[model samples]
Target: MPATVIVNARWINEARQTAGGLRLENGRIATWVNDRMGWNGEQLAGMPKGPRLESDR
Candidate 1:
């Protein structure tokens, strides 16, 4: 089974937005956003696969 890791990772989504939440996978960070606004399961599911970066910068 794939281990779902909840990391304080930073990312920018395709729409060019930012958000934060429990990261669930390890791959290429296709897109991401800030965590100011929360996300739902469906939204999280739509998030592009991305690799966890050591830092936001």
Candidate 2:
């Protein structure tokens, strides 16, 4: 599966602007609403997997 990087932002879609649920996929970013427009999910399966970050304090 490709890696998805979701960021916080409000975006415009189809002449209407909306907020919430914004995200970026396959190195390309867009609001959640526009994700289905042209998303091909490329480079997703090659993403590196690793353990969760730990506290070093």
Name the top lDDT candidate.
1
In order, candidate lDDTs are: 0.37, 0.26
Question: On a 0 to 1 TM-score scale, where does candidate 1 land against the true structure?
Answer: 0.22
lDDT of 2 by residue, 1-57 (tens): 223211111112211221212233324444333454332333212222321212101
TM-score of each: 0.22, 0.15
Q: Candidate 2 clash total?
A: 2
Output the lDDT of residue 32, model 2: 35
Per-residue lDDT of model 1, residues 1-57, tens digit only: 133332334224322222233333322232232242244434655666553333233
The reply for model 2, stretches above 4 Å from the true place, is 1-40, 50-57
Regions more than 4 Å wrong, model 1: 1-37, 49-57
In candidate 1 the C-alpha lDDT for residue 20 amounts to 30
Give residue 55's error in model 1 in angstroms: 13
